[model samples]
Target: MTLKESSGVDNELNKGDRLDVPFPSICFFDLYTLKVFHVLKLAEGQYITTFALNKDNTNLLVSTADKQLIIYTDPALSLKVVNHMLKLGWEGDGLSPLIN
Candidate 1:
């Protein structure tokens, strides 16, 4: 989808007091490949407060309103972290190994 369409879908998904709805995962689009290369779900019930990528694009920083900051050195590692969190039944407040 185009950026505009993606934004619209995101807004719709976030609308209302839908506490039961799990928050969408974070996804990174690869411009060169013209596709999504990574996705991770880090928090629930909190919007992302900050997202930053290092100058070399080798590191990523994501912060949520729940006072959690996750630093990802690479997409593969990030996917692994998110999957581990899910398997452990993370509820958005627990300490995570990925947190920095």
Candidate 2:
């Protein structure tokens, strides 16, 4: 299980974070302790061919032997509130006409 074929983004990230592409699953792990934090199982017969992380280590792009490219993002780093609805907006009255 070596990543020599990887694009080497993992070499630039924090030493604590890494991914393990075992048969049928991708595992999230702490490289220091070799502890697996999470395991994402792929479709029953799928396996990974290679993977790379973004420059800042917030995104993972995986190439599968099954002819698929899967992208995994770090939610806290990759997500934003693109749009939000204020709970107190529009409906100003506590009572509605339907209540009558």
Candidate 3:
């Protein structure tokens, strides 16, 4: 999986002699599926500096050059869902029948 930046401004900003531009966008790609799953616009024109997954692989942490860190959690991997899957004898190797 990778996060790529797309260029082009969706809007413009003018601040006296300095113009703040909105050009970069963050996109989430699924490596196994070779598909783009999601996209987020960089309103402040900051580039992504770091991207990491939590130890449990349930949380994704994204850091930008503007010093902002965002955390994204998987709802399908929540505690309740895991417990339910466990009750259904899921070994965690394949797709859960309850998923869809």
TM-score of each: 0.44, 0.51, 0.45
Candidate 3 lDDT, 40-93, residue by residue in tens: 667564777888888878887888888988787877678777778778888777
**Model 1 global lDDT (CA atoms, 0 to 1):** 0.70
Model 2 per-residue lDDT at 80? 34
Candidate 2: misplaced stretches above 4 Å?
1-23, 80-100
Name the candidate that leads on lDDT.
1
Report every candidate's CA lDDT. 0.70, 0.67, 0.68
lDDT of 1 by residue, 24-100 (tens): 56776689864666667665655788989987776778887888787878668668777788679785867545544
Over 1-100, each residue of candidate 2 has an lDDT whose tens digit, in order, gives 3564365556556565654455688877799987888887788656788999878777789898889999988575542311111222333345222332
Q: After superposition, how far is residue 50 of candidate 1 from its true place, in Å?
A: 0.9
Return the clash pairs for model 3, or none.
Answer: none
Candidate 3: where is the Cα deviation over 4 Å?
1-23, 79-100
Show the colliding residue pairs in model 2: none
